[model samples]
Target: MHPLADTYGRRFPYLRLSVIPACNFRCTYCLPHGYRADPNAAGPLSLDEIARLLRGFTRLGMRKLRITGGEPSLRRDLTDILRTAASVPGVERLAMTTNGSLLTKRLDAWADAGLNAINVSVDTLDATAFAALTGHDRLSDILEGVDRAVERGLTVKLNAVLLRGVNDDQLPAWLDYLRTHRVGVRFIELMQTGDNLDYFRRHHVRAELLEQRLRDAGWTALPRAADAGPAREYLHPDYAGRVGIIAPYSKDFCAGCNRLRVTATGDLRLCLFGEFGIPLRALLQRDEQIDDLVRAIGGQIGRKEKGHFLHEGRTGITPHLASTGG
Candidate 1:
């Protein structure tokens, strides 16, 4: 049994590792304008380093892993990284989260490299709106990428960031689109953090409102089947897949939080909205043994804050989502 089991006795084994910190598109909600480019920001965890981390975590009973980034596809050695991760012992599932910009050409390769599933960040269907949100008019590319992922038999999930006035009206359209495509659609509520506060004041769409709208439109919202991430999932009455609502601001799911994040720079974050983390890069550089790393990870997990107190005037402690692993 893993030593890092939480209060509910659930083993905290899953890890979301960021392979790169820099992104090609500067989404308005993610990064602010005049985003200074950090030259040393993106160099990834080397295949050897990642493999070592994977093996070490598995040794401590980790079974699930997800690769994420500003855009994991931007990594030149992404395929190699996936292959290495898939071969790790005790890693039952390996997944990735990407912007879907380069997925059209790389879907087959990613699947062949043993990537188990994929989550694509797709906020709006309108080409103009998408371009405005991402700072790049690559809507066609993203759509094609989604199609290719489905064709390659990958579990495709569309991650939609619901901004109040910007794309809330597009929710129903996205649901209709997903019904025909047979993929999951997740609606994420914007959280106030870093540059997000500037955007959230103008665009925070609460999940309760979205859920009510869907029900009013004659859709049934079902409870989630498992203890997944922060996303509270629901099944539309006639829809094949599911719809997930991640309301970090409106309703926090801190008690059920099961995952942890490892940044590209090698900081292990216990919670997506938490401030505390330990530098894994320094430990790795010092060759501190695996058991020591596991103990450190467990110690960090033990101190996880109950939840993000957004209603209690909490705003700026959490790191940007892009840098913290999607």
Candidate 2:
């Protein structure tokens, strides 16, 4: 079969799989009130199950798999998960998004397990601000983990959520760190998603403003990075690392939508701004063959919403970003 193309003809060669929906730090933007998963909440798909699913996706032409979570490092089986994902036949890349609290101890193991890339979420350069923002004081460890990953030659990316009144003022401090570092830094735009509208309304900074600031300060847009991922890549002549801006609100952000999401619980969210989902775990549990799974997923993709609808001042999406696998 050909690659999985949605109704709009955008082929999805990527999959964002959330293995665990529970996180330790309650980042103000994502979990303002803090979080505590239900003690009885069902655990995520098993390692074997996840491997099998990846094989099926690879069979359907998926080339990259990004493992995400409330915090992927929190899972004890993460190394195993990475090893399994890397072993998939057609998976050309295996990456992860993590908070880095546990990365210090596991970085070597993960690198050895064949994780091709890693994106660590680091919103501020100040330790106090980080604790205030995420309700945790592990900033040093997070930074150290990034340094270690760099030393080990891992393709590391830093994801910073630039909240206008929050960490926007720390850009210089962040840029200083980047000047000597080889890791790419991506400044992410705050979005109007889930129960965080109030936060979004207060802190959302348009990437347009950031772009203008970068140019004023001497950074030039590099030919859009070769990745074709959401972030638009840029560069500064003086800096050793690349810069990126992910503007979900901007008109061009969703133009080439080539990805789909599966929650830790197996909910197939066709679009980030929509709540409609096909319970993939149910189908998988029923022992439906790969063909059936593909048919069901293809039909669901055909129903992918035209856009995230943020332009209309509505995110219709209600699940917390963490729960939905951000």
Candidate 3:
């Protein structure tokens, strides 16, 4: 099988496909308050288009598939998408990253469709604080979904974006809650994605500080196998769960980056922080050879930016995180 490798020799076996770019909530660090979906913009990839792309990637040795979105559960044909992805011949794992607001009722359906793992975004457990941060009072529903995912025996992970004065203090509670359960919790550092520049600058907490806190609490590094995902895992001897950090801004997390991002609109993103993308959706309809299309994608993969543009003192790209699978 042909492996998807970049110029830097990073094999791109993982594909993060955004099924939809419209989400239900507006978390402070992600979407701006009162954000509305831009109706006039072109729609996301159709189901057929998504399947074809996944198949294409599979031929290039993509074994791990992850579906992300504004909220992946909100997609009307989520189950069909999941099944199609899982049916890909060599796809060994199918997973999703969702906000959990719409997951309580769909968790079972998702798992049955070959979903092997799930990562839910829950910044705070406090109801009022959750509502304040997300501009929604769906905290109960979310946590209930999290619990239901656990009960179903699905591999579960909780992602909490750590904001210095906001929910960073909840780390201990997050760890305590994970003790008996096998669910892992990852504390993400707030990123300077588009539109939330000021908020990111003001509230962003360093992952190092949180890691130090974990060490102080007696959390020890758990040796991970080579194929582990982005999170750097740690744990206390007595806890069944693990704690992790996904820090994009703290340092160069781009080296050995082995994933390719497909924006909701079917644009192939070479790098998360770069706007240069090959428009795969537009090319799908052309009567061209699939190999030619794949070759063009390979060219861009070789040109993947060396790092987040911030390395050169640039700000977020033109597109919003809601539009990309960030």
Candidate 4:
């Protein structure tokens, strides 16, 4: 099998596919005004297009496929998408990241469709704080869904964007939840996007502070999996669950890059914060174009830079995380 390796010899065995860019919630850091449709924007990839896309990537040694979105569950054909991706011969892990608002109603159906793992966004456990942060008052219901997901035996992980003076003080509460539930809670450092400069300055807290806290609490660092996302995970003997820190701005954050992203419109993003995307939608229209599609992808993979310029105050073309499935 041909592996997708960059100039720096980073092999990409994982792929994050964005199914849609429209999200329902008005998260403060992402889309505070909610989703505004672009008049000239094309609709998301069709099921057939998605299948062809997956087939193309699998040929290049993609073994893990993570379906992401502004909120992936919003798609009407999400189950079909999941099944199509799972049917890809080389895709060993089929997972998704959702906001969890619809998890309780759709978890069983999704699991039946071959989704073996999931990451749910739960920024805060407090109902009031959650509503304030995400513009949704469904914290309790979402947590119920989290519990249900764990009960269903899916590999469950919770994503909480670490916001200063917001949910930063809630680690104790998260730790308490982790003590009993065998789930993984990840605190993502708030990142600066093309549009959220002011907000990023106000809310972005260094992830190292939390790392020191974890070290003080006796949490031992855990070894990373070959296809894992950029998270420094830790485990504690007293807790059933684990904690992870996704510090994008940290030193050498992109040194171990092993995943590539495809936008909802079928543009290949070599890096989430890259300067541009190479459109692959036309090639995905027919099965006959697989060879050309793979060539285009491999050619671009060689151009990936060593790391993102996020530290230099450049977020590239990414207006927000939703646009590229961060």
Q: Top model by lDDT, which number?
A: 4
Runs in model 2 with CA error above 4 Å?
39-41, 225-227, 286-288
Residue-wise C-alpha lDDT for candidate 2, range 1-326, written one tens digit per residue: 45887666678888999999888888988887766787887779888668767766776778888999888887899999999899888888888999888889999999999897899999988999999998999999888999999898888999999899888887788789889999889998888776887888899888778878888888888664322568877788798998888888888577777788887877788777775767777556534566677667767667886678888877655457787667
Error of 1 at 190 (Å): 0.4
Q: After superposition, how far is residue 157 of candidate 2 from its true place, in Å?
A: 1.0
lDDT, each prediction: 0.76, 0.82, 0.80, 0.94
Looking at model 4, residue 297 earns an lDDT score of 94
Error of 3 at 290 (Å): 3.2
Report clash pairs, candidate 2. none
Give the lowest summed-lDDT range of ten residues in model 2.
220-229
TM-score each candidate. Answer: 0.91, 0.94, 0.94, 0.99
Model 4 C-alpha lDDT per residue in residues 1-326, reported as the tens digit of each score: 68999889899999999999989999999999998889999999999999999999999999999999988988999999998898989999999999998998999999999999999999988999999989989988998998998998999999999999999999999999999999999999998999999999999999889999999999999999999999999999999999999988888999999999999999999999999999999999999999888888999988899999989999989999999888
What stretches of model 1 exceed 4 Å from their correct place? 1-3, 7-10, 39-43, 217-227, 285-288, 315-319
Number of the candidate with higher TM-score, 2 or 3: 2
Better of 2 and 4 by lDDT: 4
Question: Which rank order by TM-score, best down to worst?
Answer: 4, 2, 3, 1
Residue runs of model 3 more than 4 Å from their true location after superposition = 223-227, 286-289, 311-313, 316-318
Instruction: Give one digit per residue, the lDDT tens place, for model 1 in 1-326.
Output: 46366655555667899988777878888875524557756466787778777766777677778999878888999999999999998888888989888887888888998997899999998999998988989888888888888878887888988888889888767877867786788888887775566677898878778877767767665654332556766766577777777877654466666677888767787677666667776455434566677677777666666666676656434556787776
Candidate 2 all-Cα RMSD:
1.8
Best of the two (3, 4) by lDDT: 4
How far off is residue 67 in model 2, in Å? Answer: 0.6
